[model samples]
Target chain A: MMVSQRPSEVSTSAHERVYRTLRSRIMYGEIAPGQALTLRGIGREFEVSMTPARESVRRLVAEGALFLSSSGRVSTPELSNERIEELAALRALIEVELASRALPRAHMALIDRLQGINMTVAEMISKRDAVGYIRANLEFHRALYLRAQAPAMLAMAETVWLQMGPTMRALYGRLRRTEPPRNHKLIIAALKAGDEPGLRLAVRSDVTQGLRMLAG
Target chain B: MMVSQRPSEVSTSAHERVYRTLRSRIMYGEIAPGQALTLRGIGREFEVSMTPARESVRRLVAEGALFLSSSGRVSTPELSNERIEELAALRALIEVELASRALPRAHMALIDRLQGINMTVAEMISKRDAVGYIRANLEFHRALYLRAQAPAMLAMAETVWLQMGPTMRALYGRLRRTEPPRNHKLIIAALKAGDEPGLRLAVRSDVTQGLRMLAG
Candidate 1:
C-alpha cells in the first residue's frame, strides 16, 4: 500500500476514524465499565496523534459512551442501577416506535434479513459468546430501524446502546438462559402479520427483558 | 476588570466555556438552523484561541446539536421533514415513559410548579414570543422529568429538544394559534387526578402536536 494510495482509500479525519472505532466497541459490549483510557494510549493503539485521540475521547464523553471523572480520567461508564433501568426504559420507548415506523415500510426482504440475523444471534448464544451475541442482537434492531427512515431517532437509540455497552456485557454474562431470544421471534411474526400493536409489544418486551434481571 | 482577576472567575477550560455557552444558545433556540459559524469567529467572539473553539464545535457536532459540512463549515442543523417526524415520534415515546415514571413521584408541589410554567407559556403565546414559549414549554416537561429520577433518559429527551430548537422556532412562528397548549392542560389534569394512562396520552399529545403540524 503506497502512502498516496492509502490517503484516497481512507479519507476520514483521524479523530473521526478513532471515534467510529471506539463507538462500535462500546456499542457492541467490547469495553467493560470502569475501563480507564488515556489519549496517549489511544494514540499509540490507533497510530494517530494525541490531538485526534483527545478529540475522539471528547466526542465519546459528550455522547455518554465514555465518562470523565473529576480528576479527568476517562473510562467506560459504570451506570448506576437507576441509570440502567432508565436506559432500558428508553430503549423500550424509542425502539418500539422505531419498529412501528419501520413496520409500514418493512418488506419481505427486510424480514428475511432480520430472521438471518436472529439465527446468528442464536448461534452466538449457543456458543456463549457474549460480545457476538450482543452484536447480533443490536444488528437485528438496527436492521429494523434502518428502514424507519428516522436517522435522528435512530441516532438517539444508538446512544442508549453505547451507554449500555459495558453494563450489557455484565448482564449477558450472568444470565444463564439456554434458550435463544424468545421475543425476537415474536417481533418477526408481528412484522410478518402487519400487527402494529403486537410488534410494539414484542419490541418493548425484548428491549426490557435483558435489563430486567439487573433491576431485580 | 483586570485581566488577571477575569481569568480566575472564569476558570473553566476555554473549550468547556465555549461548549456550555453554545449548548445553551442552541438548546434555548437562540440560534437558528443553517446559521454558519467559523472556528475563528467563535474564538474572536468568545475571546479564546481557535483550538478551544474547534474543540467545542467538534463536541457539539458529535451531539447532533450542530452540523459539519464536507468543507468543514459548522452550522445549526436544519432537519429534514423525515427527520422531524422521526424526532417527534422519539419525543412521544420517551416523554410518555418519563411522564409515567414521574407520575408516582409527581406530588402537589410539582403539579403547582407545572401549572405556573403553563401560565407563562400562555402568556408567551399571547405575546407571540416564540423563544419564550419554547423555553416555558420545555421547562414544563423538564420539571416533570426531574421527578422521574431518571437522569439518563431525561438527558436523551433533552438532546432531542436541543436538536429541535431551531425548527421549533420556525414551527411556532408559522402557527397562529392563540389557544394555550391544550395538551398541556390535559397533562396538568392527568397529574391532578393521578391517572397514569391519561398522563401518558397527554404528554404524548403535547410532545407530538407541534411536530405533527410541520410533518403534515
Candidate 2:
C-alpha cells in the first residue's frame, strides 16, 4: 500500500487502469480463490479514489470474473467440485465450436505457431511456473479462437478462464506431475484431420482432463 | 433540466439511478444502436452530477451492453450482419450445450413451467408487446439454462442477449407475427423425450429462427 501511493500513479483514468490491472492479476492467477479485496485496498494499491475502484469491482463481479459476497466482500470464486465440472463443461461447449471454426481459417502456419507456443508451455510446466503455463496455454487457444473471428464467443471463453484462474492455479500446483500432457499433439492431429467431431472430442478431453484428474 | 433542480425528488443513489435509467432506455430500444449518448445529457436527465453519470456509462460500456466511441461518447452497439450471425452462432454453441445438460434435469414440472410461460409469450405476441415477448422468451430460455447449472455459460449467453436487445426490438416490431413457430413445440417434445441430438436440433432451430427472421 505504501509503495502504491506515489503521485505519478494517479494520472490515467482510474477505472480502465483498475480494470486492466486487476483483470491481468486475476487472469495470471496472482489472486487466490476466496481471497478478499476491498474497494479501499484496491484504491490504495492503484492510487485511485474509492469510487472508481468500486465501479471496476462491480463490473468484474457482473462478468463473474470476481465474486461478491452477500456482505459485499469481493474475491476470486471458490469452486465446488461440481461447479468446476460445469465450467469445464462450458469450456468444452464454447471452445470446440471455436476450434472447428478456427480450423478452416488455420493453415499450416497457424499450426506451426501453436506448436511453437506449446514448447514454451512445456517449458513452463517443467519449470513449475503455473502463471507461465496458464498464460502460454491460453495463448495457444486464443490464437485458435482468433481465427474463429467470433469476438463475443471468444470473450465469453476468456471470462470462463478468468473465473477459473485461481482454482486452476491451486489445481495445477497440486497435480504438478512436472509436465503438461501430450494432448496438444492430439489436438493438432484432430485439427489436421479437419475432423470436427474429433476436434470437439479433443478439446473436451483437454478441458475436462485436469478436473477429472484432481477429483480422481 | 429544471426537474433535476427540484430538490424534492426522492433521493436515490445517483450512480445506480443513472445506470438503471440509461440501461432501461437502451434495452427498451428507446435509444437506437450507434446513437451517441453524452455524459452531460445523462447527468442532466437523471438530475445527478457528471461524475456519477460518467461512471454509469463506463460500467455499462464494460458490460458490452454499451459501446464507447473513440471520443468517449457512449452508445448502444451497432452490430453488422456478420456480427449478428456471429452472435447467433454463439447462441448455438452455448445454448445447445446448455440444452443437453439441461435435458436430464428437465422433468415434468420444469416442462409444465415452460409451457405455462409459453402461454404468456403467446399473449405478448397477440398483444404485440415486443418488450414483454422478448423478456418472457429470455425467461423461458434462462429457466432451461438453470437445469444445466452452468453459470458461466449462462452469463455468456446473457451478454449476447444484452448486446442484441435493441436489434431484437427492431426485429420483433417488423415481424409482428404471433407464434414462435412449431419449433418451440418441438423443443418441449425433445425435452420430454430426453433426446440429445433432437434436443440440440430443436435448440438450434429455436436459437436460429430469430436471426433468420432478422436477416430476411
Best candidate, lDDT-wise? 1
lDDT of 1 by residue, B28-84 (tens): 788888999999999999987787898899899888899999978999999888788
Cα lDDT, model 1, residue A181 = 85
Worst ten in a row by lDDT for model 1 chain A: A1-10
For candidate 2, give the lDDT of residue B145.
Answer: 88
As for candidate 1, its clashing pairs are none
* TM-scores of the models, in the order given: 0.93, 0.87
Tens-digit lDDT track of model 2 for A132-153: 8888988988988899988877
- Cα lDDT tens digits, model 1, A12-90, are 7778889999999998889988899999999999887788899999999999999998777999998888788888888
Please compute the TM-score of chain B alone for each predicted structure, in the order given.
0.94, 0.85
**Model 1 stretches astray by more than 4 angstroms:** A1-10, B1-6
lDDT of each: 0.89, 0.81
